[model samples]
Target: MRQRSSAEHRDLCALAPELSESLVAWWEVHGRKDPALKPWMFRADGRWPAPEEALDPYGIWIAEVMLQQTQLAVVLPYWRRWMEVLPTVEALAAASLDQVRLQWQGLGYYSRARRLHDAAQTLETQRWPRSLEGWTALPGIGRTTAASILSSVFNDPLPILDGNVKRVLARLKAHPRPPARDDALFWSWSEALLDPLRPRDFNQALMDLGATVCTPRQPSCTLCPWRLHCVAYAAGDPNRWPVTDASKPLPFQVIGVGVVVNAAGEVLIDQRLEEGLLGGMWEFPGGKQEVGEAIEATIARELREELAIEVQVGEQLIALDHAYSHKKLRFVVHLCRWIAGEPKPLASQQVCWVKPQSLSDYPFPAANARMIAALIDHLRADTLSQLS
Candidate 1:
């Protein structure tokens, strides 16, 4: 790993000349074939796709918001469905909150959905943002996001520092650690360094090159347009260019969720606190795991702490594995029988013993969704033959 040094940044402005021609020429020949680098105007097979003329300002704005922390493949269907439902800002403004949130399920990052719903109001009759600053003023539009919308949607020359650009610049600049602390410098360099002759295409090309050719791991620098000018490739470790400190270990949060079943065979569940990690969602009761504590003990302590009822923690019902953006976690749910104390909602907003069939009506975290689905399927097996 290359150590952080002042020499890395020494007047790179002069040594690394702006190679707009290098990038544009590369895009002309090899770029059209690449899906990642294919701009809105062009398709991979050299077909011209006229999205701008077909898409209005409001549609483009909505597309930008949904793209955050979400993959292109995943966002496509949702985008189409959303556009059909709310063709204009006024349509989204008039729709109910629950209407949008339900379709937004599985995308994660609830706040983005909330803000996009809110921002639709401001953008409703206003002209499209002519500059980066204007785009940035919109709700949920951060610096990079604003830059991306301006450059991609409006065809402006604004630079983008999204995950794609971050990956590319990490290798180009060759730093190590999460780049948040150095973002200001990165943004300034991005905005200033591009060859202005083709700012829109150049910025988009860089991001495209970063995503496909100069990827996060095992970047195909040989196929990269910027490879000829990239200092990281010359340094013999192109993969190591975007440098950052090693990742902090994923914190383990162990908690026991209650699967309370009564004589009616209804399983008890609770609506999670609507403001924290799983706000406005439903999950079983649980808390963080203490170091060196047994699962049973942890469950007992969490029950007393969160639900205020004593319970006999039973066998493990099932284990669901899930990975979040920042951490990997396992949700181990257990079968429990409440022995004493009246059933009450202490930590949750509401509590209910939902029938096994009715579980599908409530929204659960992606991780919890697996266990809930499996349990419902298992319960339906016996009744299937009788119904038929």
Candidate 2:
């Protein structure tokens, strides 16, 4: 753990209490009259029907789970897929662990996906449990996950203690109190302080406000509803507040392999089997890069290692940028013409050459999608240039 500077400590330390005051008032003014926003809600202006069926429980669950260490923008696609595949507890409960894994293939944190599967199965078999406690008993249904589910599905106003919300509150209170990574302390603060009457709306507002206006990098203080009450903003060092810095030195690696092919215009792709790092997905042949080796050489080496085939590295295509939960990746795709040797799966699981027309038959890793598109584009352009 990196040590926080004294000034940074001061900024973060006051975030919590400050946040509590500000958000409370903000909620009082802007809070919805939806019980779905709170525990057992009320109706001031007949707003009860508004939160009926949040229609986004699955998206909310997937978002919270995928957001473990990932960014908001990056989680969108994965969330959309999860939504389409398993929109509700009932749908998710019916899904197999393997199917869930496939749907959540690129979302990282495989355990969350697995837990969701188990929880879904449990949800299906067991009776519809009402309280958050009952929901929490299911696998992967943490306090935040349960809150999101209840708020989105049942519109129960349970305080959602997500990271963005924690950061917002921590900064608002100028809290020097260290936020436990597992979110225990934050959960306590959130639940206790949350006005159960509008837990759902308040939590969602906090999350949205934090992600958008009360941002980590550059907060839009002028537009914030809680601007008047924010102590962190008053401290003139909002960014330093919630001094949570578990920075990891990004590990760099290289992948070298060809979009292998046969004379029939079929491309050979391998379904990655490695667990925990973009597992169970197909990719155009390649693996990690070595020091001091040119990308072309690395490509040849990777082909020999993974596919056991010799290839003449041709021209270099565009570079594809990709980032997983744990590491960053830069894939330098190359145009390669086959040299020799029959295709044999050595490092990868199964290897096959499906025609370009039938490329959609296999499931490739999300990172490889760009590379595959680039590969096809490169081929098309080369053919056009030749014809010209």
Candidate 3:
């Protein structure tokens, strides 16, 4: 653990109580309290429940998991829909993986959904974990997530070190190093500042302060409750405190995607292997465009290699770009006519033939979803022209 000076430690201890109190007071007035949007935060009387009053653990778990790498506004509808559909751990565990993935469509980071389902299944067989170790034992539940869920649902005094809180802490102390470099220090800081009596509200208020006021860029320092004490604010550059590592350019790859249609007017799709990026999700069969290969050849080659089927690559249907956190992809989609051989999942977990309309039943990556929409429109136009 990186060590701070004795004087700095003393200063932090001295400020902890006042800091927690001020933030909690600000939170009482400005914390997220929308009953309709976040029903778990309120009681039947539509008031913020007391700290000792435990909220729905399942709801808190789902919300925290969804909020991982996703913003609050983006997660709101998804969280609401998930709660309505699954409602309980039993429902989520009993539901098919396909159903779970469908609910998580367009949410990105499909792994979170899969892990949530797995954890739900585990929870169905057991009881809700009360300790940090038990929660972290589950798939996808990291220290921060477990702490957030525990604090929110049980009013545990555990602290969270999420992205928002990290930024807040970094600015508060004007820490010169990136938070990632010394996360232990940040964790300690979070613990020191946490209000043991009302952790639920205190943690939420801290997150709200970061999300709304102490933002990543162009923070509203004037409105921030902690501005008076923020070291970064005193330095006249709050944004500079959370020093970031130099970023490497995201590698870009050109992918040739094949939309294979047979004489029966069914399109061939495949389920990716149940691991790695976009794992267990359905997508059009394709592969990276190799050096010195034509886009159409790439499509034909990928289909042959991945699905063990031959295809006559036809006119381009669409070409689109999609970016992940670590990579960028240009998917050059072409309509293909299934030429020969029974399709087999040589690289994927499974392959299926279905009408384009049925494609909606399967969860596809966002880029592939767009391709499906285009394929449907194209097919619809073809049918209309034939009828005319």
Winner by lDDT? 3
Report the candidate with higher TM-score, 2 versus 3. Answer: 3
RMSD of each: 4.6, 5.9, 1.5
Off by over 4 Å in 1: 1-18, 28-55, 85-87, 124-131, 175-178, 195-198, 262-265, 290-315, 336-345, 382-388
TM-score of model 1 (CA atoms): 0.79
Model 1 RMSD vs true structure: 4.6
Query: Which 10-residue window in model 3 sums to the lowest lDDT?
Result: 1-10
Can you give the TM-score per candidate against the true fold?
Answer: 0.79, 0.75, 0.96
What is the C-alpha lDDT profile of model 3 across 313-343, one tens digit per residue?
A: 9999999999999999999999999999999
After best superposition, candidate 1 residue 106: deviation in angstroms? 2.0
lDDT score at residue 100, model 3, on the 0-100 scale? 99
For candidate 2, write residues 1-388 as lDDT tens digits: 2244344444444554455556656655554334443322334343443555443344455566777767766776777667687877788878765577777666655667767777777666766667889878877677777777677556686778776878877776676755665365566556655545555555666766777778778888887776766678899988877876677878777676577666677777876664555555567887777888888889899898777888888777667777765677888877677778888878666778777656655555666667777777877987999999
Which portions of model 2 miss their true places by more than 4 Å?
A: 1-124, 127-141, 155-157, 181-183, 246-248, 338-345
- Scored by lDDT, model 1 comes in at 0.68
